[model samples]
Target chain A: MVLGGLIGLAGCALFPLLWMLSVSLMPPGAADTLPPPLLPQHPTLANYRVLFAQDGMGRYVFNSLLVASVTTLVSLGLNLGAGYAFAKLHFVGRERLFQLLVGALVLPAQVTMMPLFLLLKWMGLVNTYVGVMAPMLVTVFGIFIVRQYARSLPDELLEAARIDGAGEGWIFLRVVVPLIKPIMVTLAVFTFLASWNDFMWPLIILTGQEHYTLPVALAALSREHAQDTGTMMAGALVTTLPVLVLFLVLQRHYIQGLLLGSVKG
Target chain B: MRPQRLTGWLFAGPALAVMTVFFFIPVLGGLALSLTDFDPYALADWHNLRFVGLGNYLVLLERPAFWSALGNTLYFVVAGVPLTMGLALAAALLLNHRLARWQGAFRTALFAPVVTTVVAAAVVWRYLFNTRAGMINVALQAVGLQPVDWLGNPRWAMPTLILFAAWKNFGYDMVLFLAGLQAIDPFLYEAARLDGASAPRRFWHITLPMLAPTTLIVGLLTVAGYFQLFAEPYVITEGGPLQSTVSVLYLMYDDGFKWWHLGMASAIAFLLFALIYAVSFMLLRLARKRGAA
Candidate 1:
């Protein structure tokens, strides 16, 4: 009975993904036919070819990669510095300021969309890649994660560096950063996947088709090509493949970060 | 001391500045915007903006569409949370069993959906539920059951979104529950068994009580997370077949971005934030009381 239940659970979990792969390779219109074939009798790459060759999917892929990477790099730098400071610094009102930031986490990001659009518009950044990447540049969760990790660092290490005449900037860059490398990687993965999978902000800010990220592009494609099941599935595959691979490779850290973010909250 | 204080500010300066300009300012500005009559007219001309205090909220309260969106959102949270949590608990229990085999593979497969992009999965699911030439209908036909228009029909549209929400989110809760289950001491179950408790009684008496904290946390997190339902409906139904699946966030998006009703959109966003805060606060209070009891 236990074995049977496990098999059933696994099958239910895997069916959608396997079906996604199967349909992506099937001959155009094959999976949509009567008694949907478990295995495509005539497998082909026509759908994928159409997506990358003519549909500007390559450009969208590049845009997703570029945006996610830049956001990850920039946010990591900002979060690590701020987190370490909040953790170890003896500045005035430091505790109050940190509390303010933490308290702001409960305010949903959606609440700021309207005015943020206007703000970006005024800055002449709307419809640009920077606009698409701006709101995500410094996440509260990122700062929190880094701060939590940084708080556990030994105070004597910092004092030793200070007594050795290491400047504050030098301590941050040379001492703090190297010690926090693992959390930085975890933060990078988290930020990258989030920025890549982000739909609403990019969908709102990046107006031009040329600047459309994968999620926004796929959403548009789905709307325009609702009847084209094969092509849509291929688009879905392209949009989801990278992050899915990233999650599978670094799933331990990703899941760890998820629980950390939730439980800490 | 002076240099250390300055250095701390220097380290935190960039992040604080970014959050202030991008996050905090916009949120406060949104609140102010909601009080004014801001729209496309105001976008084109400053003179068109008028200070209309509480006007947008009042207008939204009266509007049928707003109420429908609120109702739809409530329906989603009410239905989706339990379904997802139940499925997650069941999965966790099955995985926790000593008799279960190949637990690693089952765990990974179950979690596969959580990692996939929401827009992409919604797109695939859209096709899966298509009325004609869709697998769901084809299966129904084979089984001598009638095919339901999953996304097209008003009655089934919201339910379809709820089902998709469950499929996408149960994995997250499953992982949390698994962690919680592992934290449970094996001796508790042994004690219950030695006391002549049946399997069901053991689960109810020992397991449930021990898992309360986990359940509360999971419930609060799920409620807050699910309350912000936007991407699924955006990609799946586009708030439609008659706006049956329009969520609060979706309403804000349409008003703010689509129709350029900035003021009204800001009101919707704040209302959503308020609702989530209230709901989560009450749940946590209830959890605390239950814990004390």
Candidate 2:
């Protein structure tokens, strides 16, 4: 009985998302009825048609994909280097600098939005993809996660590589990179998911509708088409499905990253 | 070993530069901006700016909008955090059960929401709670209850958003609690069972105390997260049904981005930062004291 109840609760957890998919396939206005339809009686893709062909959701999808990909790739490289450095390399004030970065984590990102916007505006980056992707290019958490994982690298192995006459850059590229592959995958998945789902910063920085990412564009669409439930669900599905699938595919690494960053850190 | 100082700097410099220029500098600038009347006119011409020296903050203290937003945010954090944590704990406990079937699938199902875009999830939830046509109301009426104006009613709007937030967010803490649960030694529970302790007794004495550290971490994370309630109200109710759902971040967005009141918005941001920092600091202190005791 207990197990059955728990299973039902898990079903409840997935119900809204499943319902969203169901409603998105419904013909417009079919969902707005008493004793509301559980599944579309006549499933159609007209709402999606409207979204892509007319509402220009395709552009937003492209924008989201472009921004998230850039963020993941660039951030992975920068965070990997810095994180590995903090973990193994000897330097003056290395601990102090890492501590400073950790302290900065306590300050909320929202506190910087006003001035950051102004600064971006000064540099003519506001409403551009670069503006949308700038602040996230190197996150403190990313660095922290990478540092935590990189610390587990065997010091003897690094010393062996160094004694064999491998230069620091070559050692990082050939040795450390290969060793930290698991954390790298974890960080990539984490970064991509976060960058894809990020709304507030993109919403703030990208003012032009043409420049808008999926979430921002979806928000704008919802405000304009509050009554158009089918189209709205279609938008939601498009915005969420990629990350959902990505999470499902990379579940282990994603969960590992979560526990590593929170519990152990 | 040689001090690879230059190599280390070379590796770290780019990231440090990004953080310093983008994050740190802007934070310092935000403080300076908060002290001055930085508005649209100031944006247009530098000479239009005037040093206000706490004038914006003084005005915010008297503004009804600021107070209402603060109250709404506090309400969200207080109610939403407990609901999210309770549901998370319950789900984690259930998933942690020895008899639980397909634990991986169930865990993934429970955690799916954490990955979805908040604006998208909020949009989906807004439709689900529609008064006349929504599944929730349909189920309510099926159960012989009156349909609620979930978004349209002033009193109901916040509660609806709370429910939406808990559903969307509980998975995150569930994962945390699961980790916490697994970390506990099973021998304690075995001993409790051997000693004639009932399930409830075991839970109260063994489980709750053992989960205290995890509870503190989860509590701090949830509180800090819930305090920044914006996207749900922004997408679901537009902070509406008479501004009943206006959050501090929403207010900051309106003041800073919408109305171009950069100074006032910076003050709001700083206030929110200070509030979150204070609360988190307190939680950490409280947790340390408990640990010491």
Q: In candidate 1, what are the lDDT values of residues A1-265, reduced to their tens digit?
A: 8778767866776677777888999877777777677787788998898888878899999999999999999999899888888899989999999889889988989888889999999999999999999999998899899999999999999999989988888888899889988899889999999999999999999989999999999999888764457778888988998998999898888888887887755
Distance from true location, Cα of B36 in model 2, Å: 0.8
Which candidate number would show the highest lDDT if scored against the true structure? 2
User: What value does DockQ give for candidate 1?
Assistant: 0.78
For model 2 the interface RMSD, in Å, equals: 1.1
CA lDDT of each prediction against the hidden true structure: 0.89, 0.91
Q: What is the lDDT of candidate 1?
A: 0.89
Worst ten in a row by lDDT for model 2 chain B: B284-293
Listed in order, each prediction's TM-score against the native is 0.97, 0.98
lDDT of 2 by residue, A1-265 (tens): 6588687878888998999999899998887766678999899998999899989999999999999999999999999989998998888999999899988878888989999999999999999999999989898888998898889889999899889988999999999999899999999999999989888899899878988999999998888765578888999999999999999999999999988777532
- Please state every model's RMSD to the true fold in angstroms: 1.5, 1.3
Residue pairs of candidate 1 with colliding backbone atoms: none
> Residue B85, candidate 1: how far off, in angstroms?
0.7
**Which runs of model 1 end up more than 4 angstroms from their true locations?**
none
Per-residue lDDT of model 1, residues B1-293, tens digit only = 89889988888999999999999999999999999989899999879999999999999999999999999999999999999999999999999999988887788888888888999999988888887767878888989999999989999999999988898889999999998899999999988888899999999888899888889889988999999999999888989988899998988888888899999999999999999999988988887888822
Can you tell me which runs of candidate 2 are displaced by over 4 Å?
B1-3
Q: How much TM-score does chain B earn in each model? A: 0.96, 0.97
